[model samples]
Target: MRRTDVAEAWLGVGTAALMTALAPLAGATLAGNVGAQLLRDQQGWHRTTAVLTENAAYTETAVAAGDTGRAEAMVRWTAPDHSVRTAMALVPTGTRAGATTAVWTDAAGRLRHQPMTAHQAEVLGDLAGACAAAGVCLVLVGGRRVVVRVVLDRYRARAWERAWAEVEPRWTHRHA
Candidate 1:
């Protein structure tokens, strides 16, 4: 073979080998980026699911408390699967203690009437303490369940805002 032809052949072989070596690396880098994006998506999904689950639990507890005629500042629920759940709550009433405000499901899952109680104020205080610890606030106004509007300390609010901003991108709905 001519010297020039031999040189050309070697150059082509070297180019082919370089491409082969880089191809897998390039593919792997692309795959890794896609995998990371998928992981983030999954994490967002899990966070959304967790928020939905919490809302469902609170709703059930409120329904149960309202059904029992014992509108409380908090409700503890035991799921059919025997899982225990609790949440801060509120109940409103227009009348005095012992008055029936509403009907609620009892601990046994049976329907029953709930009467207002004098101990509610004490319960509300306890619930407030719990809410403070949980970064939330609770109040029973008019003997009804209501989540107190959270007014964090200024320093805490900044931190909360930052954290909320991070999670805000993942949330599509507003909490009431």
Candidate 2:
């Protein structure tokens, strides 16, 4: 093989090694950042007791066998300002109107999802990070491949033209 081919092969090997090393580092960094951000977003969230109200979706009949444990229900709760607020929240299925359940609320007394547990945050962060890492790896390696291929193709084309030019005069008995 030509020296250029050897160099190209080495470049590919180096790129692969670099990407392999970076994927995990990128994943971990992104995961930590995302997880930390998620945790921070939950900082001001608080839990409150909310009374379930009427919901058309749930009927007096027994819950179906496939009940998912939680269902959307109208609920009212007192905010920190002593003002009453109402909204839909997820509560245990089969809960009747007037039943109370724990719900999360933001500072503005708006219904919000409960604070994510550390495990939940980590899991979500890991997922996001993994996706980001995969994307990074793909773009880097794929872009490298395309660039290298283009450069090599152009080089080979030029070399072929030069070789043909040198041979044509002698082969055809024609001089420029």
Candidate 3:
């Protein structure tokens, strides 16, 4: 009968509504940040279709996920300034010298890592927001359960004590 609710009724409704609304809002904010980062990355970066200039110097097998095999090799690409540039790039193992690969570059035509696409950013952001919302909900529910359990246990303990007191006198008198 004692109120041991972790959150008031209005507070629970408010939290639920806020979480529902903030999920999309957080996703949107994260998406915007992704876009800003991509823009910053693009400032000095460009993509070039380049060809390997020599046979794979050596093949490397990575034990890590998504990075199983790689061949380090030199590649040639024409810069935006109409100059030919050669840079070291990673390619599939056993690649022939003339195999073509996509290379990202900076304003100075230096090789740079590829940037994530807009779709990837959006998807990642949405997933993050959903996970955060779920975590919040889980914490709220778990807290409420713990509080309710403690309150109920206390009430049950009081009832058990009262019942035992009534039976204890008769048992003691019989023994005497």
Candidate 4:
């Protein structure tokens, strides 16, 4: 029961308590922000059918990489404003010109990727929360270990100095 043992214990407990309480709060906030962003993305994106403007033949490099069949090619689709929009979109391999293909678009009628679903947002939120909690625990535990090590090192050094002090004078007198 060293004098600083209580201090060390308190430091560890206090750190753990603070982290356990605060980490989840911060995590939840960040997760909520992420969910909100995903909601915005879902609202901004729209799906539409497009036509292949050219042959979507598979490239030699893609074939060598074991591409099943799909490739990217230019396609045209009518936007929400009924404006013509043409952009590169994924289509079946060897798709000929004038073939219809489905695509997604943004509010501006530009070709866009699919939006994240609610389930995907939930999963992402959970992952972010879990990572934050885990990271907090890891950092707190490591910091506590460092504190404990420093306290114990001081205790051991003092013990060694006291023991040496008691023996040094007696040994010197005996030798003389």
Q: TM-score for each prediction?
A: 0.24, 0.81, 0.50, 0.71
Provide the lDDT at 139 for model 2: 77
Q: Please list all clashing residue pairs in model 2, or write none if there are none.
A: none
RMSD of each: 29.6, 3.4, 6.2, 3.8
lDDT (0 to 1) per candidate: 0.40, 0.85, 0.70, 0.81
Residue 166 of model 2: what lDDT? 100
Residues 1-176, candidate 3, lDDT per residue (tens digit)?
A: 33433334545676667667765666566656665666566677778899999986454343343464676689999888889999888777677888898888888777887767777766765666566656666666666556546755576678779988878889888542
* Candidate 2 residue-pair clash tally: 0
TM-score of candidate 4 to 2 decimals: 0.71
Write candidate 1's Cα lDDT for 122-163 as tens digits.
Answer: 454444444443331111121112111232234456767988
The clash number for model 4 is 1
Q: Which candidate, 1 or 3, has the higher lDDT?
A: 3
Order of quality (TM-score): 2, 4, 3, 1
State the local distance difference test value for candidate 1.
Answer: 0.40
Best by TM-score: 2
Off by over 4 Å in 3: 5-14, 48-53, 57-71, 76-88, 92-95, 98-102, 108-110, 135-176
Per-residue lDDT of 1-176 in model 2, one digit per residue for the tens?
Answer: 86567767887888789789888899999999999999998888898999988652653332564556777889999998999999888788778898889999888788898788999999999999999889879977887787678887678788889999999999999999
Residue 95, model 1: Cα distance from true site in angstroms: 43
